[model samples]
Target: AQSVTQPDIHITVSEGASLELRCNYSYGATPYLFWYVQSPGQGLQLLLKYFSGDTLVQGIKGFEAEFKRSQSSFNLRKPSVHWSDAAEYFCAVEPSNTGKLIFGQGTTLQVKP
Candidate 1:
């Protein structure tokens, strides 16, 4: 079984400030991890993914994440936030073969100018 947990329900960051969103997961083995962003009234867009090799993966919109197997965590980060970055972020895990994903509760980011 695979599960994701995003501890923060909401977060506020000033425009141009650095941001980091925490995520944790539990699975039977090494699972595929991903980060997705969904703006209001919009569909989820894949931010980044970790399947193998490099622990650090770069994503679109200047976002990146690192998979820490020891900690069972994959945290998303951005060097600078923008007002347009406000949205709901979800961390998900794929158990493979099931073609399904277990998603976290989601963290809503509010960027203030």
Candidate 2:
């Protein structure tokens, strides 16, 4: 079974500052990693995903993630974040060949002016 862990429960960053959210996974083999962002009163939006090929993948809303095999981490990053980026971020992992997703506890982002 695969699981996702987001060590940080909450993080605050200034508007227009860089942001990095950590995501670690526990799996015997390489598992699919996904990042999703949920705004207040909104559904989850797929930020990015790591399936194969490239270690670094680009996603929507100026977001990107890098999959590190050695660390079993797939961390999301943004060079510059905006106030609109404030949301709850979730990390998820899909076990081998299973369509089910195991989500992390989620990290909340607070943007400061």
Candidate 3:
């Protein structure tokens, strides 16, 4: 079974500041990892995914993440925050057999200018 946990329920960041969101997962084998962002009343958009090779992966909107196998962590990071980045971020994991994803509760990002 695969599962994900996001420790932060919500976060606030000043515009143009750095941002980091935590994610942890439990799985038997290497899992397909993903980060998604959802704006208010909108669907989730894929930020990035880690399937094979490379511990670090970059995604849209200048977002990136590093996969740590030992810690079972995949944390999202951004160099600069934007007001448009204010949204809900979710961490997901796909199990080895099934294509379905198990998602975390999600962290709502509040941007302050």
- The per-prediction tally of clashing pairs is 0, 0, 0
Tell me the lDDT of candidate 2: 0.95
Q: Please list the residue runs of candidate 1 whose C-alpha ends up more than 4 Å from where it truly belongs after superposition.
A: none
lDDT of each: 0.95, 0.95, 0.96
Candidate 1 vs. true structure, TM-score: 0.97
Question: Candidate 2: where are CA atoms >4 Å away?
Answer: none
Error of 1 at 17 (Å): 0.6
Backbone clash total, candidate 3: 0
What is the C-alpha lDDT profile of model 3 across 32-95, one tens digit per residue? Answer: 9999999999999999999989999999999999999999999999999999999999999999
**For model 1, what is the error of residue 19's alpha carbon versus the real structure, in angstroms, after optimal superposition?**
0.6
Tens digit per residue, CA lDDT, model 2, 12-84:
9999899999999999999888999999999999999889999999999999999999999999999999999
Query: Can you tell me which runs of candidate 3 are displaced by over 4 Å?
Result: none
Candidate of highest TM-score: 2
